[model samples]
Target chain A: MSALITCSHVDFGYENHDAVVDLSMEVEEGDYFCVVGVNGSGKSTLVKGLLGLLKPTAGTITVAEELKRTGIGYLPQQTRSQRDFPATVCEVVLSGALSRRGSRPFYSSAEKRMATSAMEKLGIQSLQNHCYRELSGGQQQRVLIARALCAARKMLILDEPITGLDPWAIQDFYGLIRHLNREEGVAIFMVTHDVANVVSQADKILHLQQKALFYGTPSEYEKSPQGRKFLGGGDLWE
Target chain B: MGVIMEMLSYPFLVRAFVGGILISICAALLGVSLVLKRYSMIGDGLSHVSFGALSVAVAAGWAPLFVSMPVVVLAAFFLLRITENGKVKSDAAIAMISASALATGIVATSLTTGMTTDVSSYMFGSILAMSPRDVKLSAMLSAVVLGLFVFCYNKIFAVTFDESFARAAGVNVSFYNILIAVLTAVTIVLGMRMMGAMLISSLIIFPTLTSMRVFKSFRGVVLSSGIVAAVCFCIGMTASYRFSTPAGASVVLVNLAAFSGFWAAEKGIQRKNKGERRL
Candidate 1:
């Protein structure tokens, strides 16, 4: 019912480069916010700003104080380097709950239970002891999603989660995400290149182009000129 | 064999074996993360930095460990900075610092009179030289390294795997990265007494790479590296005693042999897998 995150006139930049400028948006509780943008449109930077990783060069951003306590789970886009990391699925997944463990040196029994439950939820319990690199792309994504689930209670911020998945795998991923949003009530703020199918599912669409271009419901996005131009005038998801 | 057995009873020889084992285990544990992160050369750079500090300390007639330890740790921290946020790239920064420090150490050694023997002892290393005080220091610091490493294992794993994701999840990536560099500096300085400045980085490189040849998981590689490093150190120390060779060179030679053996084993396994696929 209340806003979970708020960004007002935020400008995020790295030295001599402003990736995001005057961006303003809010993610409400239970909101499935999909941010769609072209290359170098500051989508990742905006997410970083929201996640408190990047400080705003201007304006302000606020994350709920309570959510910061339990911690937000982040699923970054799988990079080539991450794919080569020599970690077991259990090890990788266990690290997802690291922020929640406080100054305690090791993972608590409850944290291990959370990791196991997350893996089971993502149907990756069998891969717990297997090496992460040995898994297929779809399977790896599933493991990573399970890992993210281990870190949070109500929300997830996924950066290009289905980047390398096959079409069928993408559909299954979408189905799984939809289930999380609808069934488990987990809020999702996903950065995606896939703008079509998500149009029908997203509660809000924030189209970013070096700035926030559109911030409204999906129905409004469909009617807006910028949305029509970006979405190619027809439903491409079907 | 009887003479060697009698020699082993000497307190210094016992200290050498105990201190060397602790040093090797510490080096292997830290080396796994450094190897995985592609920062293995930082160990070499930090070692050279320690060599420079030791040379200066010896030239001034000060305690070498006291002088070198902090300097090496600071250099490691500086390297972390250069790699993490500075303009210079990580590998280039390592090379530059190592070269400059080595040059300084050489010049400092030449400037000091009647110290070539002292310089060689540090440069080439001799396990027989570890006094009780040195052994105690090595053990104390090594225990710190091992304890912190195990305690922060999950945090370190997360930081190494996806630094950006870890930071986003509220993990202090820089803190852990700095922790690793500091631990490595300590290990290198202590190991310089066992493996020598000329060859110490091998302790940080060989074991992890050898383990990676046979293992696919991080824990697997860390555990295997610890075993490989200890085994090689033992064999090397024994060979050094038996053949009267330089300690550092012997340990390095043993590690090189282990690396080659692992390489051959990995290749053989790959070939067998290929054959099975063909069938």
Candidate 2:
């Protein structure tokens, strides 16, 4: 498979110091990639760099032409203001089509269909008219995933997707993500702290601590010293 | 009926109603996004900046709206920059700008205008302040604000809901944010002649809060906020006419009442739901 995103010796940082240094990674098409790191380990910075939100200080991070046209479906962490925001599920889901609509004042019929099918795929069709703030945490996450699906069908980049979820919800979320990645062949790039749980599902892993300590298949990651140290010792940090 | 006829017979009163209702609608439409973004105090801040600009205009013998419009717009952009920089908290930045502007306005007025009724009308607001020229200007600007809000409704909703996601989706978040600020600046400057700097922000805040107490959707809240604001302005204007009260204060009191009523009704509904669940 062709690489969807290729980064070569990428460095990202603020004025004072570099947050990510000399990072090299590739997200191949249909790849289920998990990036694991402790807090302040530059996972977020790398995610921002990959998504083109932040410019790399050095080196090139090239996105595939097709992926650039479709855009990467991005699911950012929820903020405090979003919890009580008064928006219908349908409205929230439809907003995912904003980039695609591009200069259009309203969502086109096709965009509407995209949102509708996304909701149906996520089994949130019944909740489309409900208030977003009134939904449970799992339902809210499902709505967001549906939104991400509307943005792009090729790849999804999620940041800390399962935070604040119950154990059951976390498993359910993983199941949904797995179905999308494996069954639908949608590439998954998730930045998460649940390394122990995700290590079992992820095809490839990138262990980071300001730099890529290890990058390979999950099995190789398990064998690598950095992964063993992180999974065994750093698991407690979370 | 007689009071209504008497109030309508005066051309100035007619102008006030036309200008006031349009400005109310503009404020309410922009208010929904502002309230959701936690930038409700932005209206208050911009109005203070407008007050400062007005004082400077009065001191310099320039037309108030002409002077305040550009100054307030610049202040709005400056405020957005300070908040986005992450060095100071949003509320603290607003508070700092608001207090400094108000002080500058007060000093400027005292040093030159000496708190003249003309300046005080801009501070406390008067129905008589809506001159024919002001009404015409307010109407034209209100139309622009309403048009832009409708045209950019979806983008505004996306930006307010999630800035990061919007940016990721290739929406220009900063551009939309600046659009919101500029629209708000224009609405505040237009409404300030009738609502006053002190109470103009109430026009931007109360209707949204009241609508949110009952409405569960962004569109519903936005529509309801406009209706609520317009209706309240009419009621307040009539009451001000009959009671010889300040127009701005009267309008604010009406909004406060509406907010209280909605809050109580929401509580009642919640209680009823809980009781039904118990059964």
Q: Tens-digit lDDT track for model 1 on B71-175?
A: 998998898887767534778878988989988887888887655677888788977767787789778978887777688777777788888878876788888
State residue A82's C-alpha deviation in candidate 1, in Å.
2.7
Model 2 chain A poorest 10 in a row by lDDT:
A229-238
Alpha carbon deviation, residue B50, candidate 2 (Å): 1.5
Q: What tens-digit string does per-residue lDDT give for candidate 2 at A132-228?
A: 9999899999999999999999999999999988999999999999999988889999999998988899988998899898989998887777787
Q: Write the per-residue lDDT of candidate 2 for residues B1-279, one digit (tens) a residue.
A: 889899999998999999999889889888888888888878889999998898888888898888899999999899888766764488888998999998998888889858788778888898987888877877887778777768888888889999999988778999978988888898898889789989999999999999999888999999999999999999999999999999999999999999999999989989998999999
Docking class of 1: medium
lDDT of 1 at B87: 39
DockQ values per model: 0.61, 0.84
lDDT of 2 at A195: 86
Q: Which regions of candidate 2 are displaced past 4 Å?
A: A233-238, B275-279
